[model samples]
Target: MAYVTPAPLTEKSTRTDALTPLGLLTVLLGAALSSIDFFIVNVALPSMGRDLRASPATLEMVVAGYAVAYAVLLVLGGRLGDTYGRGKLFRWGVAAFGLTSLACGLAPGAWWLVGARVAQGAASALMLPQVLATIHATTRGERRAKAVALYGSVSGLGVVLGQVLGGVLVAADLAGTGWRMAFLVNVPVAVAALLCAVRAVPDSRAERPRRGDIGGTLLLGAALTALLLPLSEGRATGWPLWSVLLLAAAPLFAWAFAAVERRAENTGGSPLLPPSLLREPGVRRGLVLGLPIFIGFSGWMFVSAVTLQQGLGYGALKAGLTLVPMGLAQFAASILAPGVAARFGGRAMGVAALVHASGLVILALTALWVPWSSLGPLALAPGLAVCGLGQGVELALYYRIVLAAVPAARAGAGSGLAATVQQSCLAVGVATVGSLFLALAAGPGMREAFAIVLGVQVVGLLGLAALSLRLPRRLA
Candidate 1:
């Protein structure tokens, strides 16, 4: 792929640069593709295990490999986009994603699939940051706000859609492809988006792009790997010596990463993630808020999928269908998020947290009281829908809060840093929350386990609600 240099735009000019509707759609498609892949594989895991004779440990890797790789490389990918050209990186990322998806679909064994998943995640890292960066750089004021909200909506919907689509595709067995179709489907979508992007997407780069922070990048990657790897694999692997050691070293690596970044900033070198960015009150508080939200969200999705399939003995299609109401509710709430934010200001997040907690409470009650034989998707629909609505609103508000203060020049870096936080929390959520549920299920039975997990999530939501009070009175 030839590197296309981005045309320079002044901060003044960038604020006025109108991102075409088609361009917005194209980038949003990229966002959807990346988000969907993360969750789609959850539903397909059973099929994958059956077909490939995958051990539980290997199955865990299929999910963790992509998540950890994506989380680790995201900041670097954002930096590359800012230094080079976002449009060029976006095209390359999409193409790579398509190819990697092909590799995943065609993999003949479990380990090959894990390798392919990691590569696919790397491709996703290259692509996803550009979506927010592009929106931030090319649009300003109300348009930018709306675009970000839409992106949030698309992201949340993608999570629900991925599992739903995965179930449908696995059950459909299109062309006898079975579980592979979930991945193979990305190929055509990527091609179409790639072709459309050339005409629709405008090229943009940071006004004063700096040299890559290789030292900071390496340390950040190492730190995230040390933290996430151990958490993800520990339960399945029986908490081995290596996992324990890695977990212990995670804090040390993180401290080193922080020290290196601070040093680089002091020396006037561009750190991969500028520590000063966190000094922006919006950026700092938003990230702190996002940690619990994403962790709870991803954990719930993973546990719900597993409980529905294994505990309830539901088919892939049924398990996937169960989440449709949630997806629809989230989609609706996202469309309304900007106006809600405008009206309620930061209080909207508190309201969203309360709403989310209510849904969890409802789900917990259902789990505790309902007979195992009688519980079904319908029984869970109201809670799921309510939960989705809260998630959509909270996510939209969270993105707005985090990026509101970021300068257009540093959009890629800012967006990348935010994305890294979101993705890493997502991985951790699955590792920690999913692990908790699985362990509890083994002893207390699925119903008790489900209720306990919901209770834990409700507590997290309460914390989020309290923290939202600290946000600035109004969004930028």
Candidate 2:
């Protein structure tokens, strides 16, 4: 027996409202905002510490809390879109994110701000996974490519732009709120996103939905908390006994979570994360490569911020300005990506990793030799700019690669899984590489520590590039 296939919906045949230019813009706006918030708050940390009288540990938590919650809930959030409606969840998340941003802005104490930040992360997790899912489901070849490129640029730009904007905002101390303005500023943007999302973003869902795997969700959340929380907080807490226990139990909990999810999937239940996604060749390669790219990326940013500010005693604005070379280089490089890929094949990414690693070595050398007071744009700018040059396209290409192997049916789950991995690696970067920088600062001190840590990042990135050379065979 043969089943009949449905007709393709052509642009001319479909309603004007479907895949309209306005719709794409709205979706793109939503994607940009989610990316921006992920890193905007970093520059605000110094002012937040003073305003809230936050301890060093709590201060770190303010950042880590958001990332951890965001990573852990993302798969579930994507699934929620599958079962309910992507449009509905996106709208709700946009609204909730606005309210939580307000809460973060208003909080009087460190703990209160931390809690609100966590809520904001949850709200973000709810909104972001739907972005690619909705776009993939709704668009076709050329349109999809353009939309994806925009998405990729926005995501990369957000991290850099966020810091620049936050630095200016914090320094400006608008209405005397100082760092609080970073959170407060999101309110208006959120409101705008909500209004546009309702009008322009169409409703979408998984064609076939199943009952959610509640057990898997619970166990996965537990495993993430067990592993991430302790690593993120342990150093500030003087490495307590319980922290070690949590670290030790992480693998066991993770295994159990994976087992539970597999069982759920086998029984016809829709697991929060489908195990089948883990088997995709391109997706798996993307995961492996994405780990080091982001780890080096996130860890370096964390260290750079502190080094520029505390180590060199520069104000937030100056530290932020120091990264202008990076941002500008990245913008230019992003536009060259397609051409580069066309000429070099997918190996453009491996070449990018090598270029970025060389830059890191130069940056590390500058910290070693250059006077803290005499540091000029020319001294290290070229290398750091090169790092940004590589980063701009390399990261997005992986996003493209991850989506390449996934089917329409698994788009939501795949996006969720990929985003979760990206988010988790960021946290791990902060814990492993970022913590190494901070620890090195305490004893070997900031200069030497910065050099050593960045050197390590250089090695990791080179290794990742080596791995990338093996990836053509892995492409779907």
TM-scores, all candidates, are 0.96, 0.92
Candidate 2 lDDT, 368-443, residue by residue in tens: 7888678765776877798888887776667767777766555667778878887887778877897788878999
**Residue-level lDDT tens digits of model 1 in 2-29:** 1122235544234345579998999999
Give the deviation of candidate 1 from the true structure as CA RMSD: 3.8
Count clashing pairs, candidate 2. Answer: 0
RMSD to truth, every model: 3.8, 3.6
For model 2, name the residue pairs that clash.
none
Give the C-alpha lDDT of model 1: 0.89
- Per candidate, the number of residue pairs that clash is 0, 0
Alpha-carbon lDDT, every model: 0.89, 0.78
Local lDDT at 207 for model 2: 62
